[model samples]
Target: MEAMLEHHDGIALFTICRPEKRNAINFAVMGALEEAMEQAAADPQVKVFAITGAGSEAFCSGGDLSEFGHLRGTEARQMLMRMGELLYRLLTFPKPTAALVNGTAMGGGCELATACDFRFAKEGSRIGFVQGRLGITTGWGGASMLFAKLPYGRALDVLLRAEPMTAEAMEACGWVDAILPAEHWHEQWRERLAPYAERSLSVLQAYKAAAGEKWRTAWFREQFFAEIARCAELWGSAEHEQALRPFLCKK
Candidate 1:
């Protein structure tokens, strides 16, 4: 499986397992992730959900363009909608979600981490919203979510610049909640999240529910979907198509 899920105590860990592809997301990985998330949601014993990538080289580089680059127009729009739905699920999930950014998280990978309630990265990890270089914008509702989590100017800078920043830099900007040293990062994350895992499921759900009240409204949904539509329109553009080919070839 390109994605794998493991459950221990009250924590569910989802790992993107394709290190050779820099843990990029493809249809199979998305499907596996959805299933894992569904399982985690339905299981009363699961109190905290966590996500990470398999290897140290990258948490996730981004979408697997080799698989998705051929899509155009409506097809690309549908792809954006699909990813949006998954990210929305994560963003408003009833349980606390943590992203273990063990390495680099670029483009959609950064979006995935953004959707989580907490983001903890290894000290040397890098992250970015590098879609500009690919002739696209953040398609999975990342810009809106990022703005909600960070200062408006910083969010704008990150999106407009489309540059990779160190985890330390991002934490300073209030995007990354925590930055851990490379060695024993996983152990440290466990210690940090363990307390939450021990809490009752009902308590965790209630707290998340209260915090997510604003996001549960229709306005946020509409705005998120609108962004997806906008990105899809750009996905079929000549600039996007031209940039995509070279990026995939280099990968």
Candidate 2:
């Protein structure tokens, strides 16, 4: 499968397997991810869940905007909702979600990691909210989560400047929980999950759900939709279209 979904010892793992695309997420990838999350939720044996990219180049580049060029009206709306729903699913998930950010994380990649309770980054990886470069805010609730996690100035610097920061820089800003050597990132992550695996799955789920209470309310979803609607309007504007032009020209 282009998207990898597998379970191991009460720890369901999701991997974005399309390294050739820099682990960029397509609609298919989104669907697979949603399915995986649901599976993890349903499995009594699962406690802590983790997601990451297959390779070192990228965690995810974001939506396939080539597809965006073709979408209009309802299709565009559906895309927005799908992206938000998937982010919501991850954010409100009952289990403690972890993101093994093994490489460069930008745009939607940042959103994915932001949804998790812990982001375990690989050393040398970088992270950014690149949506500003395309004249949009974060497509998911990343901005809100970022503000919750970062000092105000740091959050403002990332959201407003749209600058990419090295994994170390991101850690300095409080974006990542831990950064490990790329050569042994997987091993270290497995070790981290070991303690989680030993914990009672039910207790883990209960505590995780409690932690997500503020972040995953109906009111929050409403706010998120309003924010993304603004983004859609921006995406349809000349300035944003102009910004996205270069990505279209990439061969």
Candidate 3:
């Protein structure tokens, strides 16, 4: 399975399971994630939802270039919209959501982590919102979420520089809530989430609702879709094609 879902002890764990490809998001992975998230959200017993990638080498590298890099115009638009919708759902998911960043998270992968309510990183992990390096803006509403979650200056810095930052740096900037030692980061995150998992589902939902109300507004929805549309238009641009060529060649 490209993505695997496990529910146990009132927690739902979603693992992106393609370590060889750095757990890049492919169509199959995307579909599985959507389904797993739906199941977790609907299950009354699930109090916490945690997302992580399979190996320590990477949490996720981004979208799978081999699967998506060749698309253009309308096809690219559809792909962007599909991913945008998925991330938007995650951003507003009712349960307490956590991103366990075990290693590198780049581009859309970083966006995926940002969509969650809290992010915990392994000691040496790194994250980068590098979409601009690909000649496109964030297509999954991550930029919007960053603005909502982090200080304005820091969010602007992340978007403008398009460079990776160490987990330590992110923690210092308050983007990552905690940084655990690499060897036992998985256990650390589970402990962090344990308190929530023990809570009643309604209590968890109420806590999420207080913050999620603003995100659920129609104006925010417009901005999120607008960001997707903007990136989709750029997805077919010559610069984007040129920028992604070397990566596509590696694939």
Candidate 4:
């Protein structure tokens, strides 16, 4: 399975399972994530929704270029919008959501983390919104979500730098809620989530709805889609193509 969903102790843990590819997102992973979100959202027993990657090497490396690099123009826009929609769903999910950053996260991976209500990164892990390096802005509505979730200057710093930041640095910047020990991070996150998970599902949903009111607005949706469109335009640019070549070749 490219992804798997496990329900335990009132938490729905959606794991991206392609560790060999550094847990990159592909169509299969996207489909699995969507199904998992739907399933978890409808299940009364699930009080919290969380996402993570399979191994400690990476939480996610973003979209798999090996699979998606061939897309251009309208095809690129369609693909970008698909994940944009998913992240928007996550941003407005009725239940509390968390991103368990077990390892490094880059580009779309950072976008995925931004969509969550909380982020828990393991010690020594790093995160970067490095899509600029590829000549594209955040393609999946992450930049919009980041602006909503964080202060303007902080969010701008993350995007403008386009380089990895340590978990400690991210926590200081308010991007990460907590930094867990590298060992037993799974247990640590579970413990951190326990209080929220112990709450009634309805209560959790109510709080989430209230906290995410801005995200549910049509105005926010417009901005989100607009960001996706901008990134799609960049996706077809010559600079992005040039930058992608060396990265793919090295891979």
Candidate 5:
């Protein structure tokens, strides 16, 4: 499946469905998510949106690294811009949002979770930013959001190191808002959101919109444009290609 969007009560859940590849994302999945978010925004019926992967294995592993070899420099930049813009939209979305961290959330997967307002993880989930080992920084603005969400030193430790971090360790850094055993993730998540769901949808949405609007300012756009340029240059490099060799066959 490209992606799945389902609604229960006022919450819309989006799932990335390619578990065989650990839910790696592609252009189609991105577009499906964008469309789902747009629909949620337009409908008065939906008040909360949550994103997660389909399997118990991963939230989102990252971009499909295996798919990177075909596009060079400029084409690659266009792709980055598209995905970055989508994440920006999600980050600034006008309703309550959450990420169900079902398992390992790496690279773009981590970025997707970070874009949401709340990240609720399974106790067993191991979250990390893997871009550094790939010879790049976070490509979809996950780093910027991570910095905003985490305390100064903790943010540095996680984003800079780009290594595996257990749910408890991440919670210590204020990365995971709430954690429960893997089997209890769904029940805990729905319960955590129950209070917000009780409020009038309009009121809840207005509060959500106001908070996001405060940061959805000029500077966010500026950062995005700058990162686009950086990613474009990085995509053209021999070093990045070399580091990505195992994941990408250089077709």
Candidate 6:
């Protein structure tokens, strides 16, 4: 499976299951994620929705360049818009959401974390918004979400630096809610999330609705779509193509 969804103890854990590719998001993975989210949302027993990757080496590397690097022009725009929509849905999801960062999370992976209401990262994990390294801005509405969720300077630092930051550093910047011990992180996350999961679904949904109200505003949606469009334009640009060569060659 490119992705797997499991329901346990009122939590729906959606895992990206491609350890060999660092759990990167490919088209099939995207579809699976969407389906997982839908399934969790419709299940009355599911009080919380969470995401994670399959293995210890990486939470997610980002979009799979091996599969997506060949896309250009409208193809790129459509792909970016699809993921952007998914992230937006996650940000506005009625249930409480979390990202369990077991290892490195870069580029769109960081964006995925940003979309969640809380982020719990392993002690040794690293996180970064590194789309700048590819000569494009975040196409999944991650940058806009980061700006809304974090202080301006800190959000800019993560995006502009284009380098990975340790879990401690991300915690310091308020991006990470907690840093779990590297050993038995799955058990630790389950323990940590238990309290939230125990809450009534109505209570959790009400709080999430209030917290995500701004994301539903017309202004925010306009700005987010604008960002996605800008990124799509850059995705077809000479600079982004040139920057992607080194990464693609490795594939």
TM-score, candidate number 6: 0.98
- 32-67 in candidate 6: lDDT tens per residue? 999999999999899999999998989999999998
Assess the local accuracy of residue 15 in candidate 3 as a C-alpha lDDT between 0 and 100.
95
What are the models' TM-scores? 0.98, 0.95, 0.98, 0.98, 0.95, 0.98
lDDT string for model 3 (1-251, tens) is: 79899876888999999999999999999999999998999998889998999978899988999999998989888998899899999999999999989989999999999999999999888889999988999988889889888999989998999999999888877789999988777678888999999988888899898989999999999998998899999998999999999988998
Candidate 6 Cα misplacement greater than 4 A, ranges: none
What is the Cα-based TM-score of model 3? Answer: 0.98
What does the lDDT read for residue 180 in candidate 2?
Answer: 88
Instruction: State the lDDT of candidate 4 residue by residue for 1-251, as single tens digits.
Output: 89999987999999999999999999999999999999999999999999999988999999999988879999999999999999999988999999999999999999999999999999999899999889999999999988887899999999999999999989988999999998888799999999999998878888887988888788999999999999999998999999899767866
Pitting candidate 2 against candidate 4, the one with the higher TM-score is 4
Among all windows of 10 consecutive residues in model 4, the one with the lowest summed lDDT is 242-251
Top candidate on lDDT is: 6
Task: Give the Cα error of residue 163 in candidate 3, in Å.
Answer: 0.7
| lDDT values for all models | 0.91, 0.82, 0.91, 0.93, 0.83, 0.93
Question: Is candidate 3 or 6 superior in lDDT?
Answer: 6
lDDT of 2: 0.82
lDDT of candidate model 6 versus the reference: 0.93
Cα error, residue 181 of model 3, in Å, equals 0.8
Q: Please identify which of the two predictions, 1 or 2, would achieve the higher TM-score against the true structure.
A: 1
lDDT assessment of candidate 5: 0.83
Candidate 1 RMSD to the correct structure:
1.0
Q: How close is candidate 5 to the true structure, as a TM-score?
A: 0.95
Clashes of 3: 0
Model 5 C-alpha lDDT per residue in residues 95-163, reported as the tens digit of each score: 889999999898888888988999999978999987787777777887778777787788878878888
Error of 6 at 100 (Å): 0.1
Ten contiguous residues minimizing lDDT sum, candidate 1 = 242-251
